[model samples]
Structures are given as C-alpha cells and as structure tokens.
Target: MSAWIEMISDEDADADLRAALDLARTPHGTVDNVMRVHSLRPNTMRGHVVLYRAALHDAANTLPTWLQETISSYVSLLNDCGYSLANHWKNARHLIGDDARADAIWAALEARAPERVFAGAELALMRYAEKLTLEPGRMVAADVQALKAAGLDDGAILEANQIVGYFNYVNRCLNGLGVSTAGDIVGYYAENEAE
Candidate 1:
C-alpha cells in the first residue's frame, strides 16, 4: 500500500532534511518507509529517532535487548501492524536464536496465550503489554503490581511500559498512514539469513 502522506525522497529533501534522512538510514543501508513518512517534518523525525533510540537502545536500560524486541514485536502484532511486526519479529529472531521459537512466541502473542511459549517475568511483561495495548483505559495499579510480583523492579516495569506505549504510538502511525511493508520484509529476511 502506498503511504497516505507523500514519502520524502532523497532528491526532494532540503539540506536539513537530507541530514536527518542520513541519520535515519537502516542497517540495510536505506531509509525506512516510516522514516520517509516522517521526513515530511524533519524536526519531528529527528526527535522521533532520538526518542526511539533512548527507549530501545539506551545503554543504561536494564531490560534485556531480546525482551525489548519481544515487547515491540508483541505490541506490533497486537495492533496488527504488518510493517513493525515484520521488522521487530526479524530482530527478535536474531536475538532469540531460533526461528521456530521466535515464530512460536509471535503466535502465542497473537493467540493471547503466551503461556504456550513464555514463562515467569517474560510472561508477565507480555501480559502487561497486552493489557496496556488493548485496554489502556482499564489499566490500573494492579497491572503494575503484577509485574512487580513477577520480579520486575520499578525501573524495569517503567521501561516495559514505555516500550509498550512507544510501540502503540508507532504502530498507529504506520498503520494509519498505510506505510508499505513490501520491500522491508524481503530485505529484512534476506539480511537475517545472511547473518
């Protein structure tokens, strides 16, 4: 599907936007449709990249990278965002170490039955992600309590909630804008296979 907004092309970018676009390139050596969509407002895109890096890549984060990827992928799947789902799932596979397990975790998340594949604090976090995504209004202190009961300290719980919130916002942006996943899926899987 074509994006609702005109994706900014390198040829069309101004000097400032070109610099932002340069910073937005994926490891696969191309700008993502998400970034291209946001490129219409380069300053917003710059702030977005900063927030994204901090939420998912800050060195001070205590949550495991794989768990962060899992939360992201789970949130994407819950929102049925094909773009984010494919990309995050690919990253989760790289971190989780087995294709079947990665697929199973995704399936379990989709089924809302993570017990089939996850346990302990991981399961708690996934459950929290689900509740927060599907029913943010209904979420109460009890939800946070569950994460704590599962052994997540306050900081870890905060990080998990932020990741969940971030993905929910991003998923809506991509899905609402009809961001295409066409090239991304193929490129991501090919790169994964090479790795």
Candidate 2:
C-alpha cells in the first residue's frame, strides 16, 4: 500500500490522464499501480505504454509468449522486485502450464543453476538475461554467439534483449517507488473469483 509516488485513482484523474489510464488498465478493470504512479505525468505514461506494448506485445514478435514471460520473470527475480516477480511468474505459469516446471525454473534461477531446469535456447536465454541484468558492461560478442548457437536468429535475439532490458528498467521503477504487490496477479485473481 506504500508508494513513493501517489497512486492516482481513475475517478480523480484529469481528463487527459484518464485517457492515458485507459491504455494502462489491466484485465481486471483496474489500472496497474505502476501505471498509476506514472500517471503523475500523463504524457510520459503514454509514451511508456506505447513503448511497453511495442516491446512486449507487438504482433510481429517472433519469440513465443512463454519465453518472453520466462525472461521477464527471471529478470524480475534477479532484480528482487517482488511485485514484478509475482506477476511475471504468474504469467509464466499460465503460459507454460506446468507448475513443477515453473517452480523448477524459479528455483533454478534462485540457485544460479538454470541449466538444471532449462537447456538449449532456454538456458542460453536465461544466461543472456542474467548477464544483461547483472553485468551489461561486461557483455561480449560471445554472449550473442551463445544465443545464436541456441538457434535464435538475430531478430529473436534482439527481441530477447529488449524484453530483458525492459524488465530491468521496470523492476527498478517498481522497486524504487515502493510500489506494493497489493493489486497484482494475486489480487486480480481474488477479485475474479469473488465475482
């Protein structure tokens, strides 16, 4: 419930901000707390939603949605953003559809042994996300080479990089702003079940 930025309620938003909020609403008919925080600057929030949608949800994307969610969950875990971790892990579970595999992936990531639960392109992608999140400056061409070796093309690799980078940026925003997980997946599911 604690947010460094004041949470903007839909009812209290200015007309323009309401328009921006409309673009940011979740499936449960509530705007994300992250977006509510960003609503402090409607224009920036609009730009953020545009970039976010393009980066993560563009129709032309080649990477499978499950892999994208995997990268997001891993990056969030690496950054220790509980809000993003919980939501993205829920997404990964929904897309992946195996609770044990999802749990193993999270456990492996936590243990720094992703290879135990992932292999081939999946393992490579996980390693790449780890490097991109933890030591971007030290990244070398061999890292991309590993992804290529894992059967990813240049375009897919590029998309993976963007997804990893996006989560890092977003995780920082959520973590730094003290945004709680109050209205994330758990709450969304709870509300749906009650309805």
Candidate 3:
C-alpha cells in the first residue's frame, strides 16, 4: 500500500459516494479506495461520476462498458496514475473477463495501436485522447473530422471527449496529490457470483 491512500467510511462521504457505491455494485462491499479518497472532495468526485454515467448512456457512444473501461485503463497507464490504473485494471479484468488480454491490449496500444485489431476508428479515438491529454490546443477541426469519418456520430464524439476529459481530470487530481493505491478496493472486481 502506498502512503497517499485513505479509506472513507460510509459516514464520511456525502450522498454522492454513497450513490456511486450502490451504482457500482462493488462485489464485496463499500466504495473503491480511490472513490473513498476522492470522497474527501465529494463534490468534484460526484460530478465526475455523474458525467461517466451520462457518457455511457449516450446512444452514439458505441463502446461497451468494458471497452470504455479498457480505454480508461489505457489512458491511466499513459498518465502514470497508479490509483486510476489500479481501479481501472480491476474493472477491465472483471468486466472484460480476460485479464491477459487486458494487459496485452495496453501493450499493443503502446507498441503501435493501429497495428493491432483495434485499427481505424478505435485507433483514432485513442490518438485523439492522447492529443487531448498531452496537447489540447493542438487539436484542430481535422481531428474531429477524422473521428466523424471513422463513423463516430457527433454524440459519440462528444461522449468520447467528455469521458477522456474526465479521466484527464482524474489523472491530474490523483497524480498531483501523489495519490497511491491500497488493497481495500481491489475486491470490487472479484468474480461475480452467477458465473
């Protein structure tokens, strides 16, 4: 366990974390440790969670929940946000049901994303996320057009941007504060019972 992590009791958080804990349906019980820590900044964390749910509900955003989680894992890896990575890595494992592939996807993406099965639109979206993260100002109309050409509707594009932007926000908060991971939330992704 890293020194920066702090667990929030149900009593400590506002309705936001409480709501998220219920929505996430964490396998064991309670919120993820990252959320627990973010419970310290309840308003900000709640806003992100609300946006994340909205992003998923938008019909144009075709990526499945697990795929979105995978994308988030990739971004967390790029940003070197350990707390984010730990949370999303567990999400990818549980949601995608292939931890090895989850690991491989990131490796493949880093090596050369387009070279893998995720070429074309997916690659474009990932590249767009990188640019938005590393150089937001550099993004031009052409990038959005490329995404449109790749078959993303405006709504999907908007949702993708929102999700990516939110993760960037998360990365900054965790990385800036030097947040670290503890084992408390790892059980959130423990194997579901109905398998």
TM-score of 2: 0.91
Pairs in clash, predicted candidate 2: none
lDDT tens digits, residue span 1-195, model 3: 233556467776567767755654345664555455565566656665567567644555667767677667767777888777777767766887776776677677566463474767777787777788778889999999988999888877877787788788778777876666655555244555543
Scanning candidate 2 in windows of ten residues, the lowest lDDT window is 184-193
Please report the TM-score between candidate 3 and the true structure: 0.75
Candidate 2 CA-lDDT value: 0.84
The residue-by-residue lDDT of candidate 2 on 119-157, one tens digit each, is: 999899999999999999999999999999999999999
lDDT of 3: 0.68
Predicted candidate 1 versus true structure: per-residue lDDT over 10-58, tens digit per residue: 8888999999988887777777787778887999788778878888878
Top candidate by TM-score:
2
- TM-scores for all predictions: 0.90, 0.91, 0.75
Give the whole-model CA lDDT for all candidates, comma-separated: 0.85, 0.84, 0.68
